[model samples]
Target: MSERTVIPFGPQHPVLPEPIHLDLVMEDERVVQAIPQLGFIHRGLERLVKTRDYMHFVYVTERICGICSFGHSYGYSQTIERLMGIEVPMRAEYLRVIWFELSRIHSHLLWMGLAADSFGYENLFYQCWRLRERVLDIFEKTTGGRVILSACNVGGVNYDIDNSELAGISQIIQKLKRDAKPLIKALVKDRSIKDRLVGSGYLSQEDAVKLSIVGPFARASGVEEDIRMFGVGGYGELAEFKPQTSTQGDNYARVAVRCNELLQSCDIICEMIDKIPDGPICEKPKGNPPEAQGIGRVEQPRGEVVYYVKGNGTRFLERFRIRTPTSQNVAGMVQLLQGCELSEVPLNILTIDPCISCTER
Candidate 1:
């Protein structure tokens, strides 16, 4: 029966990386409702798809989000390849899986650091990002670029890895695993961190599925939906692959999934090197053909990144649509943000790893 108080959360906040203005209606410092205002950085990527050729737009899509750049490029390539009715080489499929998983590891690491920073665990934040820098080095050495490394093509990967490099990668992963395991222990078992995280912003499995959550959000809540397990993007050919599931849908549970996935990605990459067949990395024949409508979906670091491309058998695409994970997860965030204390809002938002740029794109 009491009147509520209103507070403006962002557009410029230390915790939020992008300008996502949220008007929070509060009652006694508890959020009663949240209204999200977006479009601060909407670059009209959907429109650009009409102007740019399918090949060139790969870079554009990669810019959708710095963290999940590989996922965007991979998804776009998959969509175009599907529309063209082209079959990727077996080796290509395995390599794609490897690259995709490695990308996942780095993203999870980056998110972990942000989550730590949000909760005021600055020390943990620095340590996690320091480890992530190693993964970046690996990416630079393998793909020859850092963040938005365009590693995938329409039919296959852009770069190839030789036997010597494969061996080196395996050794590097083994070393990182040792370094990462201890860090994970400190995060999970550290009493101070868990007190701030474990019980806050809880989401039941039913709520997660009902909200149409994707990637780690759904899986962390016990839903077993994964694009890789569906065997769509060369994951089918991989000898080892599995969907990580959990019953607890709290921030702690999400962190566990991400930590384990880091190891899993390293494992997948090492395994692929064993069976990496000898052949071309890509399968672009005589000339790049005209565009056709292609639907490609991949598991981004945050969640699912789907690409819809319509081509008119020309160099440029007729229409391109992308449904980013953050856009889809915002609904879930509204629920998670509600009924929580004002202090916990930043942690909750970081837990979802909100990429406002991707959502607005």
Candidate 2:
């Protein structure tokens, strides 16, 4: 029998955008088991609830992850709204959904670029990000912030897009959809790219269920679990919506699932823009939440994110907790790494789209 070796796979590496360390147990060139080491970027943001008022805490939640900032704020605000029994206007709900979908498109494009870069496709990487800039420009035009848009509040949104601007946004969405097709085709159909991703890290459906994987990672494994199916908020108002899935449960399936979602999000945004009603955006929430617990769930770009808030009948919340998608998907990531070649480890980790900052927070 060959002697076993241990290798450390970085809190710092060229491919990893954030800090995450893994200790890989190896036999020859194959990984036998992979151990994850977290907390490199922990900020203790959850504990800030006591100091910041419940209303102001929306900003804190938004800071948890820049890529999923809108989802975080949306979930936190929904939790506080539920806790206080405040009814947000239907128009506001539709607006929130529009921005949330836009954020999803922005996030998936960013990940696609990174995935392209990992495979040494420099030109493809640049093209992915160039399409993403138009999404950011839409955010800046409407919300006045690109990365951290302070649009969501306790009761509703802070701003509204007029009908004229909404039409312009729809035109931009259509243009983006047309521009992204050939790039996506190249990433999915190119022989060299598929060889690197197709069967590199195989996770069967049974294993995915056993690991409790969430978000696009879980959907890619044939799991039909999505928070939006419950018809929470504006999702119920859509004419039709379904969770995208693939049975392959490999690295390529994950890429395909996210690619499909990018188009789905654009469709959802256009639908909301067409149907949004004209009404007051903000509901002007009054008084503090009664002593009770509130839970909010949103389908973030990575997967499902849950927020738990405890109110003390005061301006200050008793407790605030977030269950980020990355935290839940980490187990499945480790599972995928097992039996993979050492050379394939980085790409396996990237496929899960691990958000270390969100997980650490």
Candidate 3:
């Protein structure tokens, strides 16, 4: 019989992008169980709603997570728009989708870089991030911010991309798609990469449903769940939309799902640019919201993010809350960790793409 041992796996590890602590119960090299500990970096951002006016709170929301920054702002703005009865122009909605999908591409590339690094593929990691830089460049040229884009406002977007620039952006996205093909192929199809990822952390489709996972994590487990399917805002304008999915429910499936979404996001961006209408981008919402509650949901790169706002018929909101994807996916992450080999622990945790800052916020 092997002796049981308890091992602390984080709060500071080489492979982890954020601080997340997990105590692993080990029987030899196998993990019997994993218990997660959070709250190491809570910023109390939600509580700030009482002090910050509803109009300015969008900035705070964008700071919730750097990678998902635009999505946070977009979701918050949608909730406020719904609450205040603001009618954003169709052009703005289309612009919002373009930026949102670009952010998705940026985020998925970032995750792929991190995954490559975890696989000890240094060159591949650099290549992935290098491709991500072009997306950031587009954001900087259009929105004036990279990580924390304050482009979204209460009624509509703050900036607009002209038709010519949109065409150029489409070209860049096409180029990115071509450049990224080989890197994605190497990461997904390489025998060595598959050996490390395939069947490493199996989360059955039944278990995924029982756990209620969201975003690519759930999609990887064959759950066809995506908030975008509701056809809200720019998504509604699209001719077609489908959630990328896989039934393998393992580390490899998670990687493949995200990689495919990267290409899908590029396609969505090009389609929006081609069909985008012309109109005023900002609607300049008037007056404060009534005493009511508003909820907004967005399909972020990691998963589904929900924002709740309670307006008190004043500039300041009565209450604000956010349910980030990491918080929702943590349970599923712990479920995957069980019985995995210790060497595979970091990869399993990375597969969920846990953002501790977003969870703690």
Candidate 4:
């Protein structure tokens, strides 16, 4: 309806870490419509379910997203348990919560640093990554890998946190809380950061809901759909467990929500260390389940991931569907970018923490 030109946002861009292509229909300098293209990296993970045995396919399930590795494993295990009618050991429940929150911490920190990098705040980016190193160290101490810590298993976690490891994790979480203060100030309260993010590329709450945005993207927009609130995994037992929310629905508010959540993650980790009951961490399934179908949803670092599994009485399944957060949030990214300036496009996309690899897969 207005004078316009078409502009391409990315398949490879400096601000984004993954490959997500966007075709922007713009009116003068303002973007009017944004069409997102996914499926580039879709490797047919769902199709693989019919071939791999139920027990052996957990590894394939964990590969949904490298950053959300444990959540993937957790979701897969939960689905299988539902099929087999298995309630895992109580200790395993608490252990799953620990890893879930830890993954959340790592993911938020990684995004915080990337958000800084997007705005050209080099010093802040490096500082955030420095603090994130401590989190990775904890991950390595527990899971043996920094990024892809396949810490989850079918009935429970693969390992246990002994008394010594528990004490060490407690200390590290404390130090992280302390170090995060200055970074939070710079990212959350800094006028300059606010200047670029606040009121820029806003996605109204009603519209975000309409598009089904999840994770920090939705929470930052004042939607509280966190699975943590569902009280799964030792979360229900917490003395204080609540979802973090913000109303701005802009990049700054997204960053603020995550920074605050980093502290909340620290709180969760502390409680887990204190309240974890000593016992066996896993349970043995009785045998192969009969014809069954299960749906599992996990709150990944990016957002909620839904895995629908259908088992046909044998080792393999009939259908496996994974609805990744990035895919669900893709529609919102385009909506937010509409009418935004060329310079604001990159920041807008990054606000969703788009994991193209996970979405395409």
User: What stretches of model 3 exceed 4 Å from their correct place?
Assistant: none
lDDT of 4 by residue, 19-41 (tens): 87888988988888998887667
lDDT of 2 by residue, 66-101 (tens): 999999999999999999989999989998999999
lDDT of 3 by residue, 70-107 (tens): 99999999999999889999999999999999999999
Q: Name the candidate, 2 or 4, with the larger TM-score value.
A: 2
Model 3 superposed RMSD (Cα): 0.8
Judge candidate 2 at residue 249 and give its lDDT: 92
Question: Judged by lDDT, which candidate is best?
Answer: 3
- lDDT of predicted model 4: 0.85
Question: In angstroms, how far off is 64's CA in candidate 1?
Answer: 1.4
Q: lDDT of candidate 3?
A: 0.93
For candidate 1, the per-residue lDDT at 330 reads: 90
Lowest summed-lDDT stretch of 10 residues in model 4? Answer: 284-293
> Given candidate 4, what's the lDDT at residue 95?
84
User: Which runs of model 1 end up more than 4 angstroms from their true locations?
Assistant: 285-292
lDDT for 181 (candidate 1): 88
lDDT of 1 by residue, 1-361 (tens): 5789999999899988788999999998799999999989998987998778778888898888888888888888888887877788877787777777778888888888888888778988898888888889888998899997888877788888887987888888788888888788977888888998888888888898888899887788888888777777567667756888788888888888888778888787777777777887788733444545677788887888888878787778888898988887899889999999999898888787888988888
